[model samples]
Target: MFKVGYFYTDCLVPMVGNNPYATTEDSAAELSINAEVYSLPSRKLVVLQLRSIFIKYKSKPFCEKLLSWVKSSNCARVIVLSSSHSYHCNDLQLCSCPFRYLLTPSMPKNVQNKIKSLNWKEMEKSQCIPGIEDSEFCVRIPGGGITKVLYKESSSREIPMMVLLKFVSEGDNIPDALSLVEYLNEWLQIIKPSVNDSTLSALPWKIPSSWKLLFGSGLPPALF
Candidate 1:
């Protein structure tokens, strides 16, 4: 049996004035017109994919203690999905089955740097290109998010992963390699099996189908 736990993360994208994108019964009228809009107000959207999975269980007392901390914390709910019951990136990427997990979560350095800056206006307007839009700065607020993720190391084997995530708004920070691990731990605690368990049984970890949504056209990196 397999299970998936999930949470809702919110984001705001300011539309300058009112939500020009807001649609009324009338299609002919678009209240928003072509204009220079920067430092837009925060707009809200419910991102459906801010999630992680807990698919393996190694009965370590220390892990148990951590699990206790998560349940007590109001931060958010964490869930994990893995093939071998471990979230090890190596295992995930080594899986014989072709997968896209690594492709999605791997945030490029260029993008990550942009996310850290608190001020958007300070950003050079010219450098912001189409792939990287202008007038948008993303920052991720910890403790405020509703979901967490952690990827455990595989015992020996490797697995492939494909991931898909949607940012309801681009105003928040992008998940980094390190940050992704923190959330993964949160999920591990929630779904980790009880003690007295020796080996990792069947777990909930797996590369998901969301990648299809993101790289609908772009090809994934080939695993050698």
Candidate 2:
């Protein structure tokens, strides 16, 4: 979706690590920077792609700086795509859809109503003290790095923000990624379904070449 001519390089977040590595072949050739921003003027949308993991104890500060930048840019809203640990799901969560969304209280009512119309499940609050039935309930997102903090900060600042997340485990996450995108499309309508296939989107998503070796190089023939 962020192809050249469609999206232009906007800015970079320099608060991440100094690894200076690329996550994909396209990025290796065109972008070597860590947190890069791309903008699609036609849609008035900005996408921040983080290519590296954040350093320990820096998530809050990074989120603060990010929100500050958003405010300065005068963006209408923020949508965060993230994932949590499927293993941490509760009984109710396991029985329902693995996808969930969270909206800041400050989000526009119209947008909230639209989301509600889709019947999307909101992220549920878990017991603050695990195993304690009477303990207070709070939002819990295990394995969702920085998502919880970012949501809280955005709410406190009254920034219109939405978070879409999936429950997944450690492994090839390509399918999980596709599922999340489809979920987001339900709200954004970025890709319209074809008349021939009402269940499928018009555009076919191609897996990036970089993911060919996602599980690692083929086993050495010598080993067999």
Candidate 3:
């Protein structure tokens, strides 16, 4: 399962746009969920999506409820995809990699080992305040909305969760989405890698029709 933020209406929504296997109708839940589930006799993968509306105000309850539902559903792992302000990248963070991950204390040992084998950098931890033992070493995402909250709450509950995020500035985030998906593929293999046949048809993933409007027809030929 994955939860993506739409801070600028560009976080990860487009990735789920085109051909969702399932979608939620208007509902009364704190958030709406649309899912694409791929199931075999032995394995399953579900991609979940929730719009970022009202998350700032209701993140705690929302995440708790969602995690509870996931627990009930017998899901084993959760991966959240999101972005943070590139400017917030510290000297060390920037020097390391464009992407980082956060792992809950309860994360499976195998997963942690895989991350280590890949040599991916985990988000550096910092004290919430200048100096306070109570603050402790914690991963901080300066402009990453709801990411910290979700990680904290999930960790407290001992849910197996991981977050993969990129450092980016707001703009044409379509490229960011592509980069993120590729990064995830490096870990999850969502799309099969290849040296030939660059078409997305090689995978079940579909591009949403909404992407066509990504860059509009260009200022009515006047602002140019």
Q: Could you say which candidate leads in TM-score?
A: 2
Estimated TM-score for each candidate: 0.18, 0.85, 0.72
Query: In lDDT terms, how accurate is model 1?
Result: 0.28
> How accurate locally, in lDDT, is each candidate?
0.28, 0.80, 0.70
TM-score ranking from best candidate downward: 2, 3, 1
lDDT of 1 at 189: 43
> Per-residue lDDT for 4-37 in model 2, tens only?
3221223333443322334554556663356666
Overall local distance difference test of candidate 3: 0.70
Which ten contiguous residues of candidate 3 have the minimum total lDDT?
A: 5-14
lDDT of 1 by residue, 1-224 (tens): 11122221122221222222333446324333222222212311112222232323422332343334434543232222222212322343344321112211333445334433422111111222224645453322122222122322111112111221221223222233223433333322434654666674433443233333433565657732
What's model 2's overall lDDT? 0.80
| Best by the lDDT measure | 2
Please report, as a residue range, the 10-residue window in candidate 1 with the lowest summed lDDT: 153-162
